[model samples]
Target: MTSKPVIIVTGADLAPEALALLGDYEVAFAGRTPQAADLVALARKHNPVGMIVRYGSVTAEVMDAAPALKVISKHGTGTDTIDKAAAQARGITVTAAAGANAAAVAEHALALMLACAKSVVKLDARMHAGHWDKATHKSLELNGLTVGLIGLGAIGRRFARMCDAIGMRVIGFDPFAADLPDYIEAVPLDKIWEASDVISLQCPLTADNKEMVNAATLARCKPGVILINTARGGLIDEAALFQAVQSGRVAAAGLDSFAREPMSAPHIFQRQPGFVLSPHIGGVTSAAYVNMGVAAATNTVAVLNSVREPAVGQQ
Candidate 1:
């Protein structure tokens, strides 16, 4: 029997199609919600040549445990959980399944915006309580409103197109993006805060922009501006967001991600009606799951293959 190399999947399972791609390799699971220590243990046991990160952080210690590890592929777009500096130092490649979950996340962002603008969840709760709020309730109309997007990558751009089709004027700020469609007007962060009726985040988390939507930035937003975050949770300071919503500085906020994952019970936001929360399910659709899994697997295989095989001219 041939001894196949190992690949660790830091989750329960991958799509059947994705798994089929790795028939020649042995796959090890680290379970859902794995911690850094769990990953280190698995790496040490499997001596994996690659890893597919679905949950938890991949620290330098985990890398050190897997002496043969050559690549780390993210199951989703965000790779903030991975220690990029350590990976680079050890010459281990890191990759993300970029654009695989773009449509799902973009649609979720739009859903949150509409839910906030229409007071969907609040009205439902009122109805469930046998109270009729139709007489006193007023919902904001989204047509002709300006929406400011923080990132204009694949997900952001997909969301922009949706807003445009809804008759919204789309303005965005992304210093790294260019050659955008005519429908999207490139603008500065100041303009995004000052002019937007709805502000949505679809960017990655980075050191320089941690808690970018803090009290100071929220203070600059237009009164009654609706906030939607389908991106990283750390992008917004939860405490500041709670206070803003409490003061009605922000009329409503729809959050799919939080600074802390698997948000603890009795969270402060749970008590606030102005805040609509989803447990980071923005990119968890059936289609996106398969897409992301396949993409991650493909990236892992490509990286491993490059290292396992020699150049064309080599003997």
Candidate 2:
């Protein structure tokens, strides 16, 4: 209704700081758990110039509905939820707030690693049940152990540094990464499986690497190895993971993301004590919320501004 161009935020909330940056534009929220239909309706209604994706998938259908949409900015690092190919074909740029929540995600990965290594959740549950485990409990010590990181991006590098600081030998596998740190020895995927006491996934999910951690890969890992994943759920095969945990091949697993998000109850992982799960909240910290929102808004504004700018030869 307003004269200003609209920017649609997929979620109901956006940080006030982020809002301040878009004072020239009208911001509309699609509400929480926005479905594809909701996005399509919003796009048709507002014909928004930009979209900030916080939750829900942005399909090709949604993009087709918004003729004025010039850019799609992800509130976080992952852009898998956005149909990038469609955006590219439509000449609509897609961007993400990369490294906006890196520290938060890395810290969460470390916490999960510690939790798995020390049996923290199991111990807590035992204590609450009026049982003592001091006599029989033997926690794994992280010091002097080897940690293999799957990705060496902002989150992976941060986690690698944390592991290195704790006297853990750090090995990483990222063919695309450059400027190797001395402490993190660059290695291949096979070497990581064979050498690591703990394996943490920090890569984005792609067609070639979907369900990369499968039965075959698990068999290559050392027995009783620990696993931590703060990345996409599709990186690991849930069935394979279940079997490994059941067979005691994997000592413990800490998972923040799942193949199907907002993961419903009655899931297989819930029944296993060896599995520690969180509802994809690795980057849900208050600080990360503000950081991601601000970054997303900044990227959105930049793209919009560039589009509005006059060409060098123009008046």
Candidate 3:
């Protein structure tokens, strides 16, 4: 029997090719919805050298249970669910599949932008309900509109390019980017809110950015502005957004992610007009899934073999 280092994969749906690439390691499959306690127990039994976690939080207790764990690889870009400080304290290296799902997320954001501008959701609902009300004539063309993208990271840059290609003027706000693309006019964050006809958020949610798009910011925007968020949910204040839509300050909003996941059927947005919600499927495309899964698996193997260093930043 080959005595390769054991690896535990939680909620991973890796392709055969990707799995074959990790032939030197012995992998154990853990179901997608494994309980935290069950994961801890599995970690104890497997004594895994590496772990790949998908959705659930990898708590300190779970980390403590795995005495042999050397690395924790996140299947996606977000690391907010993991206890990073605790993992660092134990000297366990953490990495994520950042930029792997950028294309899919960018595409989704653009789709949302188009849907909001065209009033697609509202029109469809009205038609399905047997209402011939032609009062939904406020649909605007996106070509000449100003698009403000918050954060010019991989996803943000891609979204900006797409917007520019469609004839929209693209403006960006990314304090970290020393130089932006020629097509994107770098502007102040507040200026983005003031001048943009459509504002799409692509920035990560941080302590400094929680509820960044609150009532105060919404009040500063142009009247009937459209908002789209494909990034973290904490960036916008939900209650404030609800009020903004109710007051007609925000013409429409397309949200793929929310403060809470698997949203309740009777959420406020369902009753609110001009609101389109998705079940966090921005990066759920087949290509994106494969890209992220392979990147995560490769990173996990690299960490175990000491071929590469852990990626910096929390996400």
Off by over 4 Å in 2: none
Write model 3 residue lDDT over 215-242, tens digit each, in one string.
9999999999999999988888988999
- Candidate 3 residue-wise lDDT at 23: 87
Q: Over the stretch 1-315, how does candidate 2's per-residue lDDT look in tens digits?
A: 889999999999999999999999999999989999999999999999999999999999999999999999999999999999999999899999999999999999999999999999999999999999999999999999999999999999999999999999999999899997899999989998999999999999999999999999999999999999999999999999999999999999999999998886889999788998988999999999999999999999999999999999996
Q: How many residue pairs clash in all the candidates, one count each?
A: 0, 0, 0
Model 3 scores what on Cα lDDT?
A: 0.86
Kindly report which residue stretches of model 3 are placed more than 4 angstroms away from their true locations once superposed: 1-3, 130-136, 307-315
* Deviation (Å) of 55 in candidate 2: 0.4
In candidate 1, list every pair of residues with a backbone clash. none
Candidate 1 clash figure, as a count: 0
Q: Which ten residues in a row have the lowest lDDT in candidate 3?
A: 306-315
TM-scores, one per candidate: 0.98, 0.99, 0.90
lDDT for each candidate structure: 0.94, 0.95, 0.86
In model 1, which regions exceed 4 Å deviation?
none
Ranking by TM-score: 2, 1, 3
Worst 10 residues of 2 by lDDT: 264-273
Best by lDDT: 2
Residue 200 in model 1: lDDT: 97
